[model samples]
Target: MADGAGRRVDPDVDLRVPRDRREVAAHPAAVLGAIAAGGVLGALARAGLQAAFPHGPATFAWATFGVNVSGCLLIGVLMAVLRAAGGGPPLARPFLGVGVLGGFTTFSTYAVDVHAALVAGAPATALAYLAATVVGALFAVWAGDTLTGRLLSRGAR
Candidate 1:
């Protein structure tokens, strides 16, 4: 198997369920801890934002939408920077990209919001949100990655 950057990975590492201690060892304690801690912080940020911009079932989920789109953009930026910096600090990806940003993004919550809209008899709203989230997220990722890459290249000149 290969990772996002096309680096070869152990085929077994691709398994959804680790079969033994060897497979489990792929997730080291430090990385897991970082993810957990970052998750807490990210989740708290999401909560605070949501509380600030409260929305109901049929309303636009501005906070969640912003969180997810911003998270994707950051993911793209992080990946580009990491690539440019030759992977950067070892735990940077895990802590920031995977942990913090991963925690910040909430696909499950997005799904729930969509579901709630549909159940609230707001099919149009739900459809709009569904499309908007996907489109916005894609555009954000592209913009962040492309813009950051260009900036980095210019800086190097």
Candidate 2:
């Protein structure tokens, strides 16, 4: 059978098939460790950015916007590379794609920023920021995906 990307599926290695608990735990431990390490790095980077560009309720949160948009873009590129390569090292997805990006993107912070803006009598700014962040992140992700896919396709040729 083939997956959504048309990659051949190995039935023997399928997750749907029941496996020994020990076997599953042993392999996933390393991937979890990689994710934990990557998460630390990603979170620290995000914290540094937030610290350097601290914004108040009345001010626009440029730092959070940049982080979320850039994270989205990088995720798009990462996904493209992983797909193009039929997936990379086992830990690569868990580490970079999940742990790093997950840690870096701040949905909770975004929500708080919007709430703060509204509370500070900047409803327009809050609405604008919300719209811009969502639209910008979507566009960035699309651009990253297209660009990476094209580059990889050309390299393949």
**What does candidate 2's lDDT look like per residue over 55-151, in tens digits?**
9897889999999999989988887887787665666766887678878888999999999999999999899999999999999988988999999
lDDT of 1 by residue, 126-149 (tens): 999999999999999889889998
Using TM-score as the measure, which candidate wins?
2
Regions of model 1 farther than 4 Å from truth: 1-27
Clashes of each: 0, 0
Any idea what lDDT model 2 has?
0.78
- Candidate 1 versus the native: TM-score? 0.84
* Predictions in order: lDDT: 0.78, 0.78
Candidate 2 residue 35 C-alpha distance from true site, Å: 1.5
